[model samples]
Target: MIKMRNVTKYYPNHSEPALAEINVDVEKGEFIFLVGPSGSGKTTFIRLLLREILPTTGEIYVAGIDVLHLRPWKVPYLRRNIGCVFQDFKLLPNKTAEENVAFALEVLGRSQHVIREQVPEILKLVGLESQGHKFPSELSGGEQQRISIARALVNHPPILLADEPTGNLDPATSLELMALFDRINKMGTTVLVATHNREMVDSMRKRVIALENGRIVRDQVRGVYGYED
Candidate 1:
């Protein structure tokens, strides 16, 4: 579903590329973990897929669309096929969980009828059905993260990209979140998570891709978190 060929990204005036000679393929319905140390290009890799930043060299394809060459005006169309979540839980402080999820579809021009139908279902999917009326400040870290996941999935995007999704949670909460991600993957949404939680990665035993110094160092099926803490 996603392919990158010799992809490299260089920031302006930097001596080194953030990513170098990266080639990877992610098939539809696969759940993968991207594990790497700080500055190892995990975020760069996810940004490339989201087209948040253009690559300096090589090709990128998402769901068969040539991402590198896609026009700026067409970027929204591309994003409609991908959902994103981050460690920070970027939710509107004033908006309730239901409103936050509804906001995503609202921006996509989905009608009120559709938003009403989808918001509750997605909230329930993320195990937040009863908490949808609460604002971000009213929820715990895990609940907030679930709200974020609900918002990301409300559009029913085919691919979900999460960066350090459980970074701020306790071990039990992180495990719970991981189980939720597994459930989502089982429901046929391709899931890619960039994380530093070693225990969670090892326990999950999903495909793991390790990056270091801007290059892919290991790609293993049913892999553990192979790096030292």
Candidate 2:
């Protein structure tokens, strides 16, 4: 559902491109991992998908929509098809878990009745039904992250993009989260998780797209983590 061709991104004042000559096609319902060290363009690729930054060159298509040709007014519409999670759970501090997940549907102008019906289902899917009333500060790191995931997925988005999602958690919690992602993928949502967690990547043995210095070095099915210590 994602296609990139010779994609390159250069930030102002940077001597080199953040992403260089990227080309890949990720099909629907596929679960993929973006594995890279810091500054290797994993975040850049995510931003490109989200249209947070424009590519300096090349093209991108998500679900057959040409990202480069999208009108300014259509950006939000494009994002509606994508669910994103980041390393620092970007939940509103004051909002409860249910409210946070509901907020996503609300922003889409979904009716209150729809929000009421969908929010709890998403929370339950993410394993946060019991804590929906708790604020982010009141929850454990893993719980907070799960809430974030719930918010992202509440819209039943076709593609889920997670960046460094397990960064702040302990191994056990990270494993739990990864298992949750696996479940999400199994339900037919395309999943792309960008992370540097070698152990988790190795254990999962999913498709790995390894990046180094803004270039794809490896793309393997049931791939092991290949970066050296």
Candidate 3:
């Protein structure tokens, strides 16, 4: 669950705010899309969630932890409960797909035995079991993205944040990726995806929170993509 109340973000020396008065409440098992045009503060919203940037004003609580007041030492622990995916596949080029996912667990100090067992299961979950030995350059865009997803979810984080996840893919591949996210959501993970794909948004009929000019213009259950294209 995540909550943001009257949150505003202002960059230093900027005359205008990047995010203005954002207030959102997401339930534990909800799947929501954050849709908007470029520069609409979708990425800012996610950075706030990840604690990559702090809010200039207002409060943000993620999974009942006060993100605004979180200690620097505790930030890593907070992130352990959440997973994130981005448009660019951030995999290490030298590592194979399974190694990439397992690396996430290894960073958390998980045992090698545990890493070996869990990594394959997660790779399979993301439909990339056979691609485990492949390097990043060897896989297609979609496959590489799935590897990233596997890395993010291998920890079984209760929440997942994806920013422009399908941005670089073709329409058909984008749909397939969206279906993967849907399946992940159905397995009880809270999913928040920030994207600009109107067709996919309309077809999914999921909860949508639309932002424009740094403000939420619409919050609808089973919402269509309502903004002018």
Top lDDT hit? 1
Q: lDDT by residue for model 1 over 124-196, one digit each (tens)? A: 9998899989989999999999999998998989999999999999999999999999999999999999999
CA lDDT scores, all candidates in order = 0.95, 0.93, 0.93
lDDT of candidate 2 over 38-154, digit per residue (tens):
999999999999998899999999877899999999999899999999999999998888899989998889999999899889888888789999989999999999999999999
Q: Candidate 1: worst 10 consecutive residues by lDDT?
A: 149-158
lDDT of 3 at 26: 98
Per-candidate TM-scores read 0.98, 0.98, 0.98
lDDT of 3 by residue, 92-135 (tens): 99998888999999999999999989999988998888889989
Off by over 4 Å in 1: none
Off by over 4 Å in 2: none
- Residue runs of model 3 more than 4 Å from their true location after superposition: none
Model 2: what TM-score? 0.98
What are the RMSD figures for all models against the true structure?
A: 0.7, 0.8, 0.8
Which is the better candidate, 1 or 2, if ranked by lDDT? 1
Task: Give residue 102's lDDT in candidate 2 (0 to 100).
Answer: 89
Indicate the worst ten consecutive residues by lDDT in candidate 3: 220-229
